[model samples]
Target: MFLRIFNRCASTATASRPTSFTFPQRLNRSPTAILESLNSCVQTDGGNPAYIFMDDPFLIPTSGHEKRQLALSKAS
Candidate 1:
């Protein structure tokens, strides 16, 4: 579902074509855009504490949420 939406949005940007995607302008390529990009990559913990702590640095409400929220709020 997410990949489909992402592809649609991305293709819309490139639909004009021949201009080429540019860094800092392209979605998910900027430093500030990374948090939004990573939000979609989160996976379920499956009841593993170690997996929650070690394997998921970007897990919301565990590690990256506070910092990501702060950064995004500050940007706005």
Candidate 2:
């Protein structure tokens, strides 16, 4: 059902000449590995474990409620 709607909308937006897209190789392209490579970029303030999270346990967010609250607070 969603695909039909998407195709209808996309058909109108598409050009007369259809273009082909070739995706990049994905052998070792794991999402976790990609994020792990970014660990060195995180700023460490005084080498504190909770420094990045402002020392708030709620900010660590193990549940949906905590996650939403943290997201809303940051958005404000």
Candidate 3:
């Protein structure tokens, strides 16, 4: 349901563009706009813990060992 609505909105937004932008140009310009749109959507839904953590990194584990493990896994 959310994906359907998101797809519709994305298609509508892309269809209305008047410029002949390439795919790469569109991709580069999309992140900020997409983030703003997602933020608004999630805000309305009262945001889940996962999304909340993504925006505020400090909410993640603070223990030195845990941080080191996470960093090591991410590096690989």
Candidate 4:
């Protein structure tokens, strides 16, 4: 799920030249941390995928493709 999100975001950044928002120097400073967060969210919600938007909107919104990818991942 996370890999898919990263790929989508990277692809979007490559395809669109628009300078709308500057991405962070790194998406998540630590992949382990993000994974941990996802796991915690899952545990809290009975294995549901984490939508870490309300907590950190800026971190998650730009990659619409990511959300879609995650949905697809969930569906599969």
Top candidate (lDDT): 2
Off by over 4 Å in 2: 1-18, 29-32, 47-76
What are the per-model numbers of colliding residue pairs? 0, 0, 0, 0
C-alpha RMSD values across all candidates: 19.0, 14.9, 15.9, 24.0
Query: Please, what are the lDDT tens digits per residue for candidate 3 over residues 12-74?
Result: 999998886656543555648888887878744453333323534764645667666666666
Off by over 4 Å in 3: 20-76
Superposed Cα deviation of residue 36, candidate 4 (Å): 0.2
Compose the digit string of candidate 4's lDDT tens values, residues 1-76.
9999999999999988875987668564675897888787864554433564434555454466877765676679
Q: State TM-scores per candidate.
A: 0.22, 0.30, 0.25, 0.23
For model 3, name the residue pairs that clash: none
Instruction: Please identify model 4 stretches exceeding 4 Å from their true place.
Output: 1-21, 44-76
Candidate 1: regions farther than 4 A off: 17-76
For model 2, what is the C-alpha lDDT against the true structure? Answer: 0.69
Candidate 1 colliding pairs? none
- State the lDDT of candidate 1 residue by residue for 1-76, as single tens digits: 9999999999998887676666675454667677866777887676654422443455434456765665566569
Choose 1 or 2, whichever is better by lDDT: 2
Whole-structure CA lDDT of model 4: 0.68
Tens digits of per-residue lDDT for model 2 on 1-76? 9999999988888856569878888586676876777886776576443333455765586666766786778779
Task: Give the TM-score (vs. native) of candidate 1.
Answer: 0.22
Worst 10 residues of 2 by lDDT: 46-55
Model 1: how far residue 13 lies from native, Å: 0.4
Q: How big is the positional error of residue 57 in model 1, measured in Å on the Cα after superposition? A: 53
